[model samples]
Target: MGFLDGIRASKSQSNNKSKPPNNHFVAKDIVFNVDYLEKRFSDCSDIVFRKIKSNHKTNKDTIVLVFTDGLVEGMSINDGIIKQINLYSQIYNSKKINIDLLQNLLLVNEINRSNNFDEIIENILSGNTALFLEGSDEALILNTRGWESRAVEESSVESVIRGSKDAFVENIRTNTALIRRKLKDPNLKVKDLKVGSRSNTSIAVVYIGDITNQQLLNYVVNKLEEIEIDGIFDSGYIEQLLEENTYSLFPQMQVTERPDKVCANLLEGRMAILVDGSPDALILPIGFIQLFQSPGDYYERLVFANFVRLIRFFGFIIATTFPAIYVAITTFHQEILPTDFVLDIAKSRVEVPFPPIIEVLLMEGTIELLREASDRLPIKIGQTIGIVGAIVIGDAAVRANIVSPTMVVVIAITVIGSYIFPHFSTSYTMRFIRIPMILMAATFGAFGIIITWTWLIYHLCSLNSFGFAYLSPFAPSNLVDMKDAAIRAPLFGLKTRPIPTPKGKKSRK
Candidate 1:
């Protein structure tokens, strides 16, 4: 048989109904006369009949038929739907059990809304049942959209030491509500968009209507509209689709779980998008400095916050360049080393046959492998793997002369520094960029390092997160926003938002 015939035959067999004359009959079948639907699906087990009693004894003549199962348990029908319907009937007793009256009561615009096919199929599948009557062409679309969901829990990956313990859950509405609950301003608007062609995932773009730029809002909406994917399971999907520079190692958008962090961004005039299934929300108009700033910073004293921020900045620098510096110094800048230190290094590397680059690569690769293995294992087991692997491999490799002891130290320090970054995405991006830096350092020493830095800066300058530069408050150097970027000055001191975003967003009150 042909394709249309084959599809019709399969649907007929599955539904146990004779195929209508036209190829496009099934859709129209639900649209035709209400009696045909009633007769075809009348005795279905999921169907129920609820009638109105005029007096103490039942009035069978003026009965309202609800083709759903009984409202109790062990039955497929829902109690809530029945309760709501009965409540409505008691309130509106004048509008008795009739087709037009029920239709009007249910606010159904047309006759097809209460048809037997749509009511029985839609309501039953949604855990309610079909509602039909002797003469009505319409049925009430009962709200039985019930499904179980998990409660919000603290974020395992982005936990803070001093900040709020509340984190996001899988529910987008709940997540948005959490933000709304915290910031009870009418101007804080959530624009919902149905993303993912298949998943139809509910995504909400949240921002302060007055504070956020209208141009930026339109840009973001246009970008979202351009996305034609089958599924967007996480915020990362939007990040990937909307990022200005996809090839750059640096992240253009910042994804976080904490509502406080998202709120902070919104106050800075940045837009936040929360996806239905993912706990993480993507914050647009993010800069390079944002990844370095943590939620704990604002929750602590300025002195301690500044000290911690400085440490993180240093950590990122050390993480990116420590191994490369080791390779460069050992291979090309040996003359710059102190006499005793040079002798010690020479002694350490004497037994190693491979060059310093090769030695560094070996140790770096081993550290990366250990890190990956540790991350993939369970918490307890992952800790064990990290400890055992670091000790056994670092000690064994050093003793075996597979890599120099100093090189092992550099690689370990690099790995630790990468972990110290506040945002996981930034840390991951830094981890990836490290290899290229190492290669460049090995090829051309300090000059190679300089070239890499210059190239990175160029890329950063080119990168934009929903029209706002990724290097904002640094490249443009906004003195006003600088207080909150490099260091958490004081809660009161942050009187203005990041300058790259729309102005007047930040507040002292």
Candidate 2:
């Protein structure tokens, strides 16, 4: 292992410096401290430590600079640190070294003193230069953290017609800045913590202090603190850990790459969690209806937004129950169909050997497989392959009597409805559980579809996002919240925030 306790597997021997004792404090002897660090970071080639001897009227004292390579900009080191320190001896000539003098001479924006090994190691690894004086127990940590990162670009996943073009990159500081740009309120609160004991990845919690509910904020913060994972590569990990219902298929927290969406939620009294190295942010206390909402909903006019929301609601119903209903009606409740349309469907299925349920399962299963393959493939070819592949495969299957023509229509419409969800993960829930719903319909007809949805609603009611109801405004039925639930009211009409406002901030009445 290297400077980080469990980072690397390489090790080497140092000739003059044995490992330091259990006391992990910096010693006044700079040579002893340098040897201690060199031994700890034995095999780490990226860690750089340079020894410098300060000029003195009588005797010279040594100074050591330790920093990680590739993280600190060269100009920052050249113009800022090295040039200033090199020019120090010509300017100041003193017998006794001054800690305050050295601190003042450093050309860095931020500097902090730390006497212990923990702080020194942390700062060095976090792209900052550590200054260990010859005869001082404390070292100064300089802020030279700069590196090349992907520039902010249009969101590829969450694109919109009328909204902010910029999206969050893999940088946490940049992500926070994006959120800050949207809401410039003094009440906005941002907190940072380190998770993943092995990785020590940075995580941030963002919310409006006065508008956000204290209990809700505490629940989110506590849930995050309780996670004891070795590493968290993405916000998805934080989302799962913060979820109240671990077994539920539905996502309790909404994940978005758009800063506008996050800011909108925070203004609604919700909290968001952003993880370092991950582009997505997790919005908490989300409900079932939010899956259908998009950032464009607010950007567009209220009349148009209301109309689009209704279409989404209809799409959800069609996606969840349409296939099951088709299978049930054709298999058990055929009498309900119109006589002429029934004849057309019967003629189409004359060559098909399988039952309606089996045909649907086979078609739906094939679509899911093609969808997965397309996703795993490169984006350039994936979209073309998915569209052409679905059409070709469906036509061939129908021609070969593997599935009925009408069955292909049902599955295609179901697939379209599945894609109607604004959130990709939410769309997956429908694609994932559609087969089971079809099975129920195959077994017990319309009654089975009724039973499955009824039980599903019950499950949704039982689930909670942090402490708030998952099916909020619908199960509990708040008319005020209803103004923005399935329909978008005018801006002035939505005076009340969607989430519960913090006490004393605003009266619900």
Candidate 3:
């Protein structure tokens, strides 16, 4: 009874948070006064301010509009707005006006009056203008947001050899347009959500209407609604927040810079999230096979794609476990190797003071250091670092017998395998997972390696990305989905979607 009571008390206390309760706040309650708003936002480096005054005899009101930096270009006191203000002034004075005047005075700009504080702030942040009337409590917000942004370039991460050259930009609207340009169906829906308490990043949830499962869409929405963070710097923040397991090292949400890749996921009935200020968009309910897939697979010939896929799959295994397997076989099961090969390996290690595991750790660590340093340096310097570091370090270490020449070959092959694994993010993940394999090898040799592998499989099986099983179309066995998983079948052979969630009303046509 006491344990249960304690648990209930803890839950109650957790529910009573210190943050502001979620509730409806009216316009008056939310908006700071125009002057206050300016003062508060003036210090912000990104805020832009504009002042527009009425030129009519009756109305002496000044419109103070604020927007994000560089979003609004030119503000003109045009005839339409001036005429509308003149009529409003006359009405305020209880003066008689011509009946035909209403049509000309009633402008399209009246949509601005419907703006509440939240809407005004939303518009302002999005690079739109928020207007403040001197006598009125409501502010007129205009949507004239535009700014200089980096032009769409070839995707840096998911570059295709033969497909589209255009990649997603930092602008959310432009990114949506890129996808919309490719997929021109009206069924493609984009739902907007404001994430991040401080950053207030604009995020768009996009999916095909008839194809996507409603239950899964609602689940994603509910998960996003549950987030209470102050800021979301990247798609990674939302990924971690919405994921089932916080402790898992494996990424549940897949991010891609390519619009085509996002379109491909949407066609498979998965949801895509586009965040403002980020070129990369998150694809939910991604399977392990999806991570291994390259956009190049869909662009090139089937035979070429299949060959590439096979190489990647082989590379995956070699990159992840080759070092561990080598260490295990050499240290504990030397009989597995040929007698001559064993003799050669033994002779190579004669001058080395460290054990096999230490030699591997030293070599792998140096390689990683060189790789990281090269990435940070300028492009020209980066090449220099790679060439000079690899050549000088390998020659010096092998000749000095700090590490065996055989060990050098194994490490070099492992590094090369990691680079060829299609997705750099997944390759990085595998690289991180390699350390544990090395540790396991050192602890209990072959048995430890097997145990580690089993644990990894169990964890992968347990993982669910946005309610879809991570190891889908493999662990449960879906024949139709398998056509594009391990091997790339011909385009005509793939006649169905990957089945991300439960079957909906729409199937592949």
Q: Which residue pairs collide, candidate 2?
A: none
Better of 1 and 2 by lDDT: 2
Please, what are the lDDT tens digits per residue for candidate 2 over residues 1-509?
A: 32322111111232443434655888765666777888888999999986554654432355678999988877777777777766787576554555676799878889999988877887788789998876687898989889779999998878888978999999999999999988898999998988887777889999998888888788777777888999999998888777768888899889899999999888888889999999999998888889989989988988898888899889888888899999999999989989999999999889898999888888877988899999999998999889999989998998899998888888888889988777677887887667778889999999999889988999999887777788888988888788888886787777777656653343221
TM-score of 2: 0.92
lDDT of model 1, residue 437 = 89
Give candidate 3's whole-model lDDT: 0.75
- Count of backbone clashes, every candidate in sequence: 11, 0, 1
TM-score (C-alpha) between model 3 and the true structure:
0.85
When 2 and 3 are scored with lDDT, the better candidate is: 2
Give the worst 10-residue stretch by lDDT in candidate 2: 4-13
Kindly give the stretch of ten consecutive residues in candidate 3 with the minimal lDDT sum.
Answer: 22-31
lDDT string for model 3 (77-155, tens) is: 2344444655575565454333233324534343355335566666777666665543445565555656789999998
Put down candidate 1 lDDT per residue, 133-219, tens digits, no spaces. Answer: 423434555443334566888888788888788899987878998999889999999998877666667789999998888898998
